[model samples]
Target: MTISNLQEVKSRITVFGQPMICRGCSHEVFIPYELYINVEKPGIGCLYAHDIAICQNCGEARHFSDPSDFDNEKGIFVWALRQYVC
Candidate 1:
C-alpha cells in the first residue's frame, strides 16, 4: 500500500520479534522466538516484511499484530486501540 503519510498505515500495524519497550511498565522485552500476532492476510511477500512494533522501554503491549485483514483504516485502529493488544 502506497501511503503518503505514516498515519495512513499506522492502523494496519502489529508487533513482532523482540520487544522494543513496554506501554505500561516501560520494561524492555526480548523474544527468543518470534513473539507476535499473525497478520490476517500475510500472503507470500508480507511474511518477512512484518510491520511489527514494540515499546522501546517497557514491554507492555503496544501493537499486537497486523490489521491488514480489515478493509477500513479507521476500523483497524479502533480495534487495535480497544484491545491494547496491539
Candidate 2:
C-alpha cells in the first residue's frame, strides 16, 4: 500500500481512490483489502492484491487476485456477491 497520495480513515478509504463499495448496502464505503507487498527481492516496491473481504450483511466476497506476472500481467480484483442461503 505504497500509494503516494493514499489517505485512509476508518473503514472507508478516500481521496481519488478506487471505490470499495459494499454489496449489501450501496451507500456503504470500505477498504479492508489485504495487500501483498513485494520488497524482499525481484521487482521491489510492487503492490499486489492478495486478500478477501466478505460482506457481513449479504455473506458475499471480494477476491483480490495477483496475476502471473506482477509487472506485465494485470490483476483482476472485483466485488462479487454470493447470493444464496441454505
Candidate 3:
C-alpha cells in the first residue's frame, strides 16, 4: 500500500514479528503514530521516541520502543527530538 493509504489500511501492524491487536475492542487494525515519552524527571526528561499505533476502533494507543535508540545504548538513551508528529 502507499504511504497515504497506510493510515487507512486498518490492518495488523507488526512489531518485532508480533501482530498488534487493540485490547479495547479487539480490533486488528491501527493508525500508526510515533510518540516520545519523558523517561527522565527532575530536569529535562529523557524524550524517548516510540512507535505507537492507535486503535482505529476504540482510540486506544499502543507503543513500541524504536529500535534505533539514537545509536546510544547507555546514558539512559538520551537524544534530541528529531521526529515531528504533525
TM-score of 3: 0.49
Each model's lDDT comes to 0.34, 0.42, 0.56
Q: Is candidate 1 or candidate 3 better by TM-score?
A: 3
**Clashing pairs in model 3, backbone N/Cα/C closer than 3 A:** none
> Model 1 lDDT vs. the true structure?
0.34
Write the residue-wise lDDT of candidate 3 on 27-70 in tens digits.
76776665677888757977976666778788998764433233
> Each model's TM-score, in the order given?
0.22, 0.31, 0.49
Model 3 per-residue lDDT at 61: 86
lDDT of 1 by residue, 4-57 (tens): 112321122223333345557655442212234446576543333323344434
Candidate 2: which stretches are off by over 4 Å? 2-10, 13-16, 24-49, 65-86
Please report, as a residue range, the 10-residue window in candidate 1 with the lowest summed lDDT: 1-10
CA error at residue 85 for candidate 1, angstroms: 18
